[model samples]
Target: MPAGLTVALVAGEASGDQLGAGLVRELRRQVPGVRCVGIAGPAMQAAGCEPWWEADELAVMGLFEIVRDLPRLLRLRRALIARLLAARPAVFIGIDAPDFNLGVEKTLRAAGITTVHYVSPSVWAWREGRIRTIRKAVDRMLCVLPFEEAFYARHGVDARFVGHPLADELAPGGDAAAARRELALPPEGPVLAILPGSRRGEIERMGAPYAETIAWLAARLPTLACVLPVARPALLAPLQAALSAAGVDASRCRLVEGQARSALVAADAALVTSGTASLESALLGCPLVVAYRASALSLALVRGLRLIRIRHFALPNLLTPTPVVPEFLQAEVTAARLGPALERLLTDPAARATQQEEFGKLHALLRCDASRRAAEAVAALLPGYRAPNEP
Candidate 1:
């Protein structure tokens, strides 16, 4: 449509990288020779994004973690702002990394550059005050969840729900028997998928509790097998140490690298750290017990500030009218709590079917060709932009 049109993007973590990559591919298809540049990971780089900085540089988690790296992050943001302002791209899309990208978006928007935020921060759940900053920062807020569009509209922000890429990528009711065969586990017995989390901080907090949960479940079910999927190779050492400390038998548990979806598909139930993985587990037709423990100081700050607004933390629960999945947070995220919840899902057909039924409905609501919709929303922000099929 336009010669050498450039779209600037910043994706802070692996999930955002994936979202950015899909958006890049779709944007390229719509506008030939569109150049994408910003902080990107391998996926985005492979999708033809020229990275000014790697996405991992901004992948810090937790309040303490971000505070620890604040100076370096601030420097990176300033430099990125300067670069994007100078380059003057047709549109600047902040994929995720709201803390970093929101400031960048605000600055760039102030400079008259069209700005869009791809994945909304949890303003609807916590810190609703951020709506003021979001209104200033984003020309259009492209949400991945359906409910988020209405939330933003009530606040007078220009927002659109483009649906979720994961819904488009993963089919409902995944083949458990086939996935178990692929993972080399017995196709008959009850298998449990344990996804601690992708971040090191998450693993550090969740590893022990997850290991204990495995031990608890294994004691109750003699035929139980556990599949622990490490989101990255770096997490293996810590995960192994945790399992060892809990005295979980090595023979009963198998650790695979980067096959979270397959692990979820293979298992009867999952003990998932409350984040995107929990949603993944649900989407793959696996019932899950969601658990999470934030750093003490982070929890203290959130509590002191009264930042948290919602009753449910799990994505599947938040998406639906009522809580479809059980969630345990803070000190409640222990073997005692997670064990029984997972046990019910593993043993009771009714509980599993109930969650699975809700998951199927949720999947249908979100399977909206997300990347293409996001690309269209982004393109609409560009000057004199028109759809390819527009007459």
Candidate 2:
């Protein structure tokens, strides 16, 4: 490998930031002095990535939101593409921003620059036609889920299942007692972790319902203590307002900024907005009920268009052979339904045991030293790149 090989990376959101950071660390370990540059969040920047743009610029979610920001996003993409074309990095990795990165990747790959898409778009689950666009966009598709690699291989796309970084970060079993100690919670009492969602949009849709669920749980279980883990500080005010409006006692709720994993580990059960948090709870061995509510138009459009191919949306159910946790969506996401589901997980020993047992298997399947594998896969695309232990 060259002495100063420049590797460009673009991560769209917080999760991608984390994945990018891990990949950066592993790449640095294997190939010293590798220059990493592109759109990054704090984590990626902390791991020596030169941030050309803040990741939050491309962090917009939902079809409507993206449409609203389309012009700005397009301009950002054009600027990024021009810069990359001029710099001509050895490899360009797009981390989870398919809408933005795939276009950039396609253009760069056409220019003879090797491109890798770190997280495969959910083409396998929905919008299977995207496979065609992905084929042209990336030289390699690095998938976190096992099923994704199979889907790509069947379609003849060059792909590898590098496993999920979260699985490697969180083990099958967690020390609930230790987590409680860290959170300064009573070790013996019932605690619920409420994760409405990370995005402002998610909080807007889910905060009230989640708070209501918490209030319902508190009413049922007198000793119930709640922990709300806010991904961003901005989410805290809205969450608190929702909880207060729901008549939930603020004194009984501990609103903590960040430390989401710790809250998951410490809780007896969690009421989480369906997305990555469901997977995190499962990985942490925390049984949870997943709930999601989007804008009425968004849900209607998704249902009207038949966009979702899969029956299940939660990560745990998607990964598992069968549903291991309950999922409430749209109108079904009421506290009357979610509260009972969470209550069952918290109170029923059999349910908790079954979930933990399945979580162990899920963990084993995904704990494949993901960061190292991702780095190795990226390195293989570079000229003169050799494995660290190769002679």
Candidate 3:
């Protein structure tokens, strides 16, 4: 292994921040005095990464949103490229945010720097043509999901499945009773967890409908307790306003700041927006219904172009041999539709138990020590690299 190695990492969102932080810790352990520099969130900074820019700067989502912010994003990318070229790190790893990172990786790789993309772009799902861009951008691709490795292999790309970091972080067989006790909730009643998403745009799009679904559930099951976990402090006001607008009573619901995992563990079921949270709900063994709604233009463009390839959108369903959870998208994501799915998970013991059984299997499949495996993959790209314990 190289001494005093410098590795550049760019993580564009909260999930990527988490993956980057974990990978940074493992890399530091594997290579003593390793220097990490790039765009980072608080987690990565705490893990000893020097931030050229905050992760939130690159956190814009959706086609319309990206188009609006294109100029600023392009400028940021140019500045980052110049700085990285000057420093010439051993490897550059872009964690998630494929749209932004892939372009940077291509430029850096073209400059003769080894580049790794930490998360595979959804080439299997939409815009399959991105595979060629990915092939040009990365020396190696590190995927968190098991199926992605096979997809990359079929395309003849150098990739490895590091398993999922969330699976490793969460314990198998979570105790709902204990989580409820910690939240000071009754041990006997049904509780539903609502996680619209972590981003502001996500909250704006899905929060109102999710709150309405909660309201519907509350009326249907009088004893129902709803808990919403806010990922960031900024989201609290918007979420509360959305719930209020939906005529949801404050007494029937509790708004907790952070503790998303605890919220999922405590709930009998979850109403989650389709993204990383769906995967988290599954790993926590929380029976859930995944819901998503985008802007009219975005949905039209996606459907018009016929971009999606897979049959299922939810991560749990995608990983399972069969669809284990129900999904509502676009026009189908109505409170009326989502309410029944949540009700079933809350009321039907057989259904919840079956989902839990499937969740356990999925958990086992993804529980490989992900951070260490990812570090080993990144380390392999370095000249004469060896594991810390290796000769």
* Candidate order (TM-score): 1, 2, 3
Give the range where candidate 2 is weakest over 10 consecutive residues by summed lDDT: 171-180
The number of clashing residue pairs in each candidate reads: 0, 0, 0
Task: Please give, for residues 298-385, the per-residue lDDT of candidate 3 as tens digits.
Answer: 8888889999898899999989887889999987887899999889999999999988899899999999999999999998787778
In candidate 2, which residue pairs get closer than 3 Å at backbone N, Cα or C atoms, i.e. clash?
none
Angstrom error of the Cα, residue 213, model 2: value is 1.2
Give the best candidate by lDDT.
1
Instruction: In candidate 3, list every pair of residues with a backbone clash.
Output: none
Q: What value does the lDDT take at residue 244 in candidate 2?
A: 93
Error of 1 at 109 (Å): 0.8
Q: What's the distance in Å from true for residue 213, model 1? A: 1.1
Under the 3 Å rule for N, CA and C atoms, how many clashes does model 3 have?
A: 0
The TM-score that candidate 3 achieves is 0.96
